[model samples]
Target: MHQKRPHVLGIDDGPFRKQQDGEVPIVGVVMEGATLVEGVALTSFPVDGAEATAFLADWVRGLRWMASLHAIVLGGITIAGLGVVDLRRLAGELDRPVLAVTRRETDGSDLAAALHAAGLSERMAVVERTPPAWRLERGLYVRAAGVEAAEAERLLRATLHKARLPEPLRVAHLIGAALVNGQSRGRV
Candidate 1:
């Protein structure tokens, strides 16, 4: 018997300065098992705003390939700085696994503090309710919903190429930078 390669959509926010106010572009890259790029999704939302989850949900639900997606992976839990994503809600609404993966651990307390300071205390509550990160092999920290630990590992492994992040995410980061800055730059 042979296993199938998992298809995943990886999302990442475009470049933004901490002092910037207004919307920021977000890029989503879809890949067939971390190799072939199937498609891309694009959207934007306010910086440090509280609508991250809803906006992301709408962006994903609008995808033509949403039904076939095995999972949705994010570059991080927060987009455009303090905009937080409710992992559980996203997974439930999309009926797919959702995972936020990072090269290093993003302290939950720090995220909570940012939300609280931004006066997005309501979102802070959601952040508090969300599960903490689970450390995967190779120093990747993943905060996930709608998938078991074993399945999460399988999905991540399926999408991983030679980079530290999964292919979709890696490619999405580069695309996002180019979209916003006219060319891909900085750390990907």
Candidate 2:
């Protein structure tokens, strides 16, 4: 079969919470490939003042944009100190295979249950939990599939190491975070 640009979407979901409402979720979508497609930041409904169910509906609505995506690598915070963002709701929005990464400290079964509870259990892959220390320089993990294993590995490694952040998604982080921070500060 022929292939398109061979891209993967890496997501880093975050939330900002107040004393009363708890956590507010913000999603960052990063597209990694030759052209480095732009990343988008979206608020999943309740984050923007809508009801939770309605927000989930709106969040899932963005999947059409990723119809061409080959795979998705998903990760969210789980540290008790950091306060976790439930990613299963967002995962339900995706229609492709998903690799969910967590902290090495997290139990695999717990992670699976989390996704399953969110109704995304079928499309999930549990990756070895990587720590925040390692994530400082690595924004996303790139993978190449549907090709020679060696070739795929080579391409992924090259892209991941090419820079501290891949072109497409890094800008997404900047823009998305800026928007979130701006909104928080009442600047935007």
Candidate 3:
């Protein structure tokens, strides 16, 4: 059987304020191969809150084109403070595989310590439940749900263009940053 090109939706959250309680903007980009199909935005609980999974699932479910998406890609497992993504819940709700990508290998110990310091120790369990990150290639690591490691790697390879990150993810990051800062900065 011939494999179809996956229509992937990449999600990312904008930067947030450090000393205040507020919502953070989250951006989702839908893409097929190198073509961008749609962009959607939502808000999540302030940094260190535990509502990312439910908020994301609800946002996705409300999209009219949700059924056209084949897989989901996230910029990271945490967004807007320490709101952790429940990979299993997201995948189960969408009935699609989900992948979280990071630019560097994460130090679990450091993350746990930070969460503890932030009074978000409860988030550690959710973080621990995320599948361990696997190196998709040099400078790229990923954790996935509902997809095999090899297949995830293949999808990443196929979707990556000039950067190690997937195009949809890069676009989402750029859009998210621009919305927050008026101008985008950092490596996309």
> Model 2 over residues 1-188: C-alpha lDDT tens digits?
12344565655434354332434445546565645664565653232232332343355456555656655444433321122333433344544433333334333466566555656454333223322212222444322222333443333343343445433334434554555576322122
Task: Compare the candidates by TM-score and give the number of the best one.
Answer: 1
> Which candidate wins on lDDT?
1
Against the unseen true structure, what C-alpha lDDT does each candidate score?
0.86, 0.41, 0.79
- Off by more than 4 A, model 3: 1-4, 186-188
Worst 10 residues of 3 by lDDT: 35-44
Task: Give the TM-score (vs. native) of candidate 2.
Answer: 0.45
What lDDT is obtained when candidate 2 is compared to the true structure?
0.41
Name the better of 1 and 3 by TM-score.
1
- Flag clash pairs in model 3: 47-80, 47-81, 48-81, 48-82
- lDDT of each residue in 1-188, candidate 1, tens digit only: 01267889999999999769988888899999978999988888888877788889988999998977999999888898888888999999888889999999866777777667777777767777677788888899988899887888889999998878899998999988998889997553
Candidate 3: C-alpha lDDT: 0.79
Query: After superposition on all CA atoms, what RMSD does each candidate show versus the true structure?
Result: 2.0, 8.5, 2.1
lDDT of 3 by residue, 58-166 (tens): 8888876688887889988887867888897898988888899998898678778878988889888888888888776667889999888888877676668787788
Off by over 4 Å in 1: 1-3, 186-188
Candidate 1 accuracy as lDDT: 0.86
